[model samples]
Target: METNFAELVDAEFALEPGITYLNTASLGIGPQRAAAALHHGADAWTSGRSTFAEAEAAVDSVRRAYARLTNVPPDRVAVGSTVSAHVGLIAAALPEGAEVLIADDDFASLVTPFATRHDVKLRSVPLERLADAVRPGTDLVAVSAVQSVDGRTADLTALRHAAEAAGARVLLDATQAAGWLPLQADGFDYVVCGAYKWLLCPRGVSLLTVREGSEDGISPHFAGWYNADDIWADLYGPIPEGSLASSARRFDSAPSYLPYLGAARSLALVEELGIDAIRAHDVALAERFHAGLASLGLDAPSRGSAIVAVPGLGRLAAPLADAGIFVATRGGRLRAAFHLYNGTADVDRLLDAVAGRL
Candidate 1:
């Protein structure tokens, strides 16, 4: 059965009329449920209805939602403010003198944390060469599940096998692949994502998952009140030997209240719509967009993923924006990402604009 994605989610987004939004890779258009949740959070704060328990519950709700989406246990999910923040925590938790492997095109957040560490050694390899790059002494291998610039999806299963053979761990940045892609949470030892993009939520909330037994030797680099078993009790007395929360909750850092409320609602909406349906819908739109661009004598790197990267269109982003079509430019390619709210009309408009410009 053909999916009527427009009927399912178009009404829930606030995209402006005549403006085609294709920059979901850069940031997603906030859904109505997230906006309503944010409003409710504001009301609770202003009406004196907010409490510590309420805030903790909101955080737990968001964590559980992510856990469900990734098919991991709730205790394995750790909520953070951003992907970079969680990646930083992971970097800090690594053993001294650890060696890390990353791709040359990885987002700076993944590279910068380890790059700056004097005790850690960093190696950069091309995306296609990542599997071969894994070897003994490589403590961690990190890469995005989907490359942001070229729209290439990584084979996590293969990477996991290579990492395991080398006695290394895998960290996957699912910022570009999480909501619309079917992610197997067990494939990677660590998974991190920012909620603002494919998750269709506001910024300031991210989901981080640590595989079972993966947190064994890693200590929380940035511990806070929430990381403790009981904040008041810990504060009032000498900290007990095992006062920290037993699960990944020990790594939790406090985030702004508003984003969690909205994040919970955004996750609920995705679950309601069904992620498999969402992935199929996005792939169909992306294939149509690829075919349309091909007819216009333009070429894209890949066709099945949510992102379509047009060669040489990076320089035309401003012109496209002026035409009321939005996209992002990275690695000298124009990246147009399709989401549930996008339709055939948006693809037609993009193709027509590029054709007229050419």
Candidate 2:
């Protein structure tokens, strides 16, 4: 049976004629309409046509669009630059003198912010030991839903139960898993992701979700005027009392208006095409790539997400590069990540390029 990948691609985006874009988890190729939206917003800013009203609408639209994608209430999502930017918000929300629990191979962005804090103790545990590693005084249990390098998917529901049992809040760095898996809103206290990876928006823009009631005692470290509910305030006056929107909006600083507009356009396009349909298409394409690589006698590791890793053929870099193939390597494995934009042709080309080197 021919998988539904081609139909899904045809419905959403047409490829750039001859480019085989299979590294989407590294940086997604944004949709053409989204690129146009970004350019239009940039042109407005450059020409002095940018207005407060337009910026406000664009920011709100992007936040709501990300909220819908993550299955959360619209008010609970915030806008940010990258996944790391929002992790600072999570680190601040954590109780003082608290310890954070994380898997050993989690993305560094998720752990680096907490590591810099002297008051918060960092606890790094193995992925296999995470369920048993939660301690009594852990204030926040931090983890990546999918490891960016290895593509190992953590069981969020299980981790949530363990953390809640230990009286700890759950912070999920889901950049690698967003758009590839179905995320349940209630399963996390906080979650953050960059749209560049799989959502195919611009690189700097990201999404953050902080569950209602879970963020009661938290405050934004980097406060701004737009963080206020009555955002249209005269800057000439004394800083108004900080009623920071009482939701996830409290966490965001005033972001540049253009990327948010582009992100909203891209997110809306994805939703109209259907997220589930996108996941199904990508999953099948990944499977095809894996099978073809195996037939070429390359041994790739079995991971439950969109990324596949195989041992690099003993420094087989120049040969593959000469053949016009691109992939990343970590822990002795060459990594190939795919999104809905890729198809069988990209996979076959990769296999042909790497066959002899391995």
Model 1 Cα lDDT, one tens digit per residue, 1-358: 2445556585688777889999999998888988987888899899998777777777878898889899999999988888888888888888778999999888887778878788998899988889889999999998998988888887677788899899999889999998999888877889999889998888999888999888863568677676787766676544554998888888788778888888888888888888898898899889998888878777887667999998877988999999889998988898899998888888888888888888
Q: List the residue pairs that clash in candidate 2.
A: none
**Per-residue error (Å), model 1, residue 309:** 1.3
Compose the digit string of candidate 2's lDDT tens values, residues 128-240: 67867887988888888877766777877678778879888888877888777777755788888887878778877888888888776456777677677666663445445
Q: After superposition, how far is residue 8 of candidate 1 from its true place, in Å?
A: 2.8
What ranges in model 2 sit over 4 Å off? 1-8, 11-18, 234-242, 313-322
Model 2 C-alpha lDDT versus the unseen true structure: 0.75
lDDT (Cα atoms) of all candidates against the true structure: 0.85, 0.75
Off by over 4 Å in 1: 1-5, 236-238
Backbone clashes per model, in order? 0, 0
